[model samples]
Target: MNLFVEGFAWIFDPANYSGGQGWIVRLLEQLAYTFGATAIALLIAVPLGYLVGHTGRGRDLAVSFSGGFRALPSLGVLILLGLGLGIGFKAPLLTFVIIAIPPILAGAYAGFEAVDRKTIDAARAVGMTEWQVVTRVEIPLGLPLLIGGIRSSLLQVVATATLAAYVSGGALGVFIFDAFATRNYPEALGASILVTALALVLEGIFALLQKLVVPRGVVAKELKDVRQRSSRPLAAAGVPAQEGK
Candidate 1:
């Protein structure tokens, strides 16, 4: 459609968007808010997640609570908090923090659970203190999953922070809302595209992080062992596995 084309064209117009008087500020501000909220959420969620996951007590309760919190609508919570707290960055930031908690908590819990029981038992049997077992044994094992939770939380925060615009908190959503109101199709499309691009960038960074943290050698070794086992029956039956140099 010509209308859509024109709109996208305006978005790329550096002259119009020059002097940074346009969506750039909103994007940065929203990114800041989202990151800040996620930071706070991580502060609270990561430790609690580690503790609950390690102890195995109250984990179900935490999981249920985090799930409930995550399910709460961002706009609805923002509106209520903004209205109740007199509308500003504080309420929106808090609302985003709530949105960010669940994934990190869930991830952390999963990480803790993934630590090998036999490894834990061995640590205990070797006269390791509870603190040593957790710090030296459990946390290291859970780092991959814990990092996963942080990544999830980061992505969720980035997406939801757009809702800040609804309360005059100003974010990319503001541009989208303005475009919708004035029928400025270009701005709306542009804003959406930019937001999506930002999300993708965040996801890409986290993917690299996961690869860096998870030992590929371990995975490769495991796969090799599995293949060896599967070939054992064949080898016993006079079929040899391929030899490696």
Candidate 2:
């Protein structure tokens, strides 16, 4: 109980931050590493997913490979890479990328596949190039799923990123690691609380993004029941107004 109180006190110490002279730099550093890795992973996964799903080729291979990647323990992979890479954030960043890609890729592919075939055929019939069809038709239709996948990836990466501090990559992990090392249970618990807060914030942002990016049609579909109920009264009154007009 004493340790917890002291840890909370230390967390409020301004000097722990980069601007102040504390370990806050470690948190920023880890954030950079995780975001960078996720960016790279998404770049590769998104396009590949689109291609596989759109072409209806090697989809099983793609999905299976992603599953295999997910099956590999991140810590185990990081441990091996740390031996070769010489203990830094890179190895763990790579591990996170591997872990994060599967869902994004699978979601993108599934989204593309879910796009109506008739819609695609219509696009092609209207003189859309294959590229145009993909961009204008398939991707737009699949965007909801793709965004959901990305949101999931972002949440996953944020949670896993705390582990980066394990190899001196610098992150919120430092607080936990150092606290535990010195038997400071309060500090360790504080670090966990911060990480959880961050995860929740990330999830919230993605949820907002999903809502903002989803097509109006989807939104309309969601409101269809409400619309039907509301319209009945208005429609009944509307006839009287129209007659007056």
Candidate 3:
């Protein structure tokens, strides 16, 4: 209780809000690092993932790479890269990008895969060009999953960005490692709280995005399933089941 109180107090302390080392500055730096690395990874992964999913080519390779990257120890990768490349933005950026790729890649291709093939064929049967089918039909239908992928990547990149401080890479992580190094537990906890809150905010935003992108039919089916499942128990109990939610 005391620790949490002090932690919140630390966050609100006006003295901590001034100059280059201020919470706002650090938070911005963190966002910059996160967005930069994620953008790079997405540019590389999404196209490749889409190719695999769309043409059904290179899926084995995508899965293998995704699994490998997900299995990587982020901290160890950062340290090794630093040892090889020296402690600079390169190491941290590479580390962030590598770790960030899998979720986004998986999401991209998996999103496409999740689309019904018959729908895609129907689009083709309608005399839609390949490009038209992809842009008009596939992408729209696959959007919810694609957004989900971005959400996962954002969470991942943000978390991994914290490890950047290890390589003198800047971000909200400075508060964490720096504070812990000095035995400032309250400050560390406060910084950690900020990171958690940031992640949760991103999650909430993307969750809404996912919901918004879901086709209405899919949502209706999901709701219908839920209502039916709910009514089943009542039916089994010999209670009158409500109809038409």
Number of the top lDDT candidate: 3
lDDT of candidate 1 over 1-245, digit per residue (tens): 88667767877888645566577777788789878988998898888888898899898798788767756777888899998987678888988888888888888888889777888999999999999998888777787778888888888888988778888888788888888899987788888877888889999999898878876643453355454345577788898876861
Model 3 stretches astray by more than 4 angstroms: 215-245
| Prediction RMSDs, each to the true structure | 4.8, 6.6, 5.0
Q: List the residue pairs that clash in candidate 3.
A: none
Per-residue lDDT tens digits for candidate 2, residues 1-245, read 77667666666767554463255666566567657777887998999899899899999998788778766777677777777787777788887888778888988999998776888899999999999998888888898888888888877788888887777667788788888899877778777777787788878888998999999875664565473343456678764433432
Instruction: Say which prediction, candidate 2 or candidate 3, comes out ahead on lDDT.
Output: 3
Q: Which stretches of candidate 2 lie over 4 Å from their true place?
A: 1-7, 18-23, 221-245
Runs of candidate 1 exceeding 4 Å displacement: 1-4, 215-245
Candidate 3 lDDT, 1-245, residue by residue in tens: 89999989989997775678888888887788778888998899888778888998888888898787767799999999999998768998898888778888888888788778899999999999999987888777777777777888889888878888888877788889989889999999898888888888878988988898788866664465453356677889998887764
The better-scoring model by TM-score among 1 and 2 is 1
Number of clashes recorded per candidate: 1, 2, 0
Highest TM-score scorer: 3
lDDT, residue 182, candidate 1: 100
